[model samples]
Target: MIKAKITVTLKKGVLDPQGKAIEGSLSALGFEGVNSVRQGKVFDIELTMDDKATAEKSLTAMCEQLLANTVIEDYRVEIFS
Candidate 1:
């Protein structure tokens, strides 16, 4: 079995309203020295494949097709046994 960790994050210079809201809330709650905050999504997927390379390719394709928005977001895949 193989495991994949996919991270989807907004591109640079794009506005992150949810991140901003969390930052504001943290500051309001007296969390000092909070410079900035960005939010992202993480997906954990398990596959029955044996080859790491194939698993990686399938995970990347999945991200491109459905898990991530390529125009505004970037995705990274990490595969492990």
Candidate 2:
């Protein structure tokens, strides 16, 4: 079995309201030097595979189809056996 890990994050220059809300609360709690914040997604996938090429291809397809929103988010995939 192969373990695939995925991360998805918003691109720079995109507005993140959830991050901003968290930052605001942080500042209210006396956290200093807080100016900006961002948020992202992480996913772990498990599959039965042996070849790296096949695993990578499948992982890529998964990312492109459902794991991430390519229009506004960037993604990374890691495969381990």
Candidate 3:
């Protein structure tokens, strides 16, 4: 079995209203020196296959097809045995 971790985040220069709101709320709660915040997503998946290469390819395909929004978001995949 193969375990894959996927991270999806907004591209640079994209406005993150949710992140900005969180940052503002943090500041309001007395958290200081926080420059900015960017929100992202992480997905932990398990594959029935054993080949890392195939697993990676499938994971990438999943990201491109449905997991991540390629236009505004970037996704990274990491595999573990």
Candidate 4:
């Protein structure tokens, strides 16, 4: 089996209202020196296939097709056995 860890985040130059809100709240709560904050999503997927290449391809397809919006988000995939 293979475990795939996927992280999805907004592209640079794109607006992130949720991240900004969290940053504001953190500052309000007395967390200092926070220059900026960016929010992202992580997905851990377990696959029955053992081939690293196949698992990577499948995870990429999943990300492109549904997990991420390619227009505004970028994703990175890491595989572990």
Per-candidate clash tally: 0, 0, 0, 0
TM-score-superior candidate, 1 or 4: 4
Candidate 4 lDDT over residue span 1-81, tens digit each = 999899999999999999999999999999999999999999999999999998999899999999999999999999987
Candidate 2 lDDT by residue in tens digits, 15-61: 99999999999999999998788989999888887888899998999
Report the lDDT tens digits of candidate 1 across residue range 1-81.
998899999999999999999999999999999999999999999999899999888898999999999999999999877
Evaluate residue 17 in candidate 1 and report its C-alpha lDDT on the 0 to 100 scale: 99
TM-score for each of the candidates: 0.97, 0.90, 0.98, 0.98
TM-score of 2: 0.90
Backbone clash pairs for candidate 4 read none
By summed lDDT, which 10 consecutive residues of candidate 4 come out lowest? 49-58
Regions of model 3 farther than 4 Å from truth: none
lDDT (CA) per prediction: 0.95, 0.90, 0.97, 0.97
Task: Provide the lDDT at 17 for model 2.
Answer: 94
